[model samples]
Target: MGKTTRDRLLQTLASAFELPEDVVLDLTRITITGNTQFLMENHRGILAYDPEKISLRTDQGETVITGRNLKIDSLFASEIMITGSINGIQFIRSRG
Candidate 1:
């Protein structure tokens, strides 16, 4: 089946189960804590990384995080955690 059809089915299932689309569809979830820590789930991969900037690809868009002394504390297949003096977060919406 096509992606659209699969997504539609997942949407319906999410609605019927009263579950968030993020849970059912494996959407990206980002959380920030105290401007010092960042966590993301279901992330595709890191596009770029540096001490001052980090970019990641997700299902919805590109996530760009800027900060000072940025460090990746943990990384997994679909989750990542970064810690530093976070200054900004930007989202570039996906065309597809």
Candidate 2:
């Protein structure tokens, strides 16, 4: 049988790390509500920060979320959620 799209993607990603099939890959998902919002996903994880309120950096890149009373309420082990009135969102990739 052929591999599913998800399985193929996973396999391709796994090849980069020389990881075995059993090696679980970490994934991050971000969601925002209100006026402004931002979402970023990378091999490292998800990062949600307010450009007007805070500055951030990552091996993957930078993501800026701007809005009124923009608040990053939760940043769990693998996901991030932002809330409040927002104006703009930007994503920047710095490296591999």
The lDDT leader among the candidates is 1
Q: Candidate 1 residues 15-60, lDDT tens each? A: 9999998989988888899999999999999999999999999987
Extract clashing residue pairs from model 1. none
TM-score of each: 0.87, 0.46
Off by over 4 Å in 2: 1-28, 32-51, 54-59
Local distance difference test values of all predictions, in order: 0.94, 0.53
List candidate 1 stretches off by more than 4 Å.
none
Q: Judge candidate 1 at residue 36 and give its lDDT.
A: 98
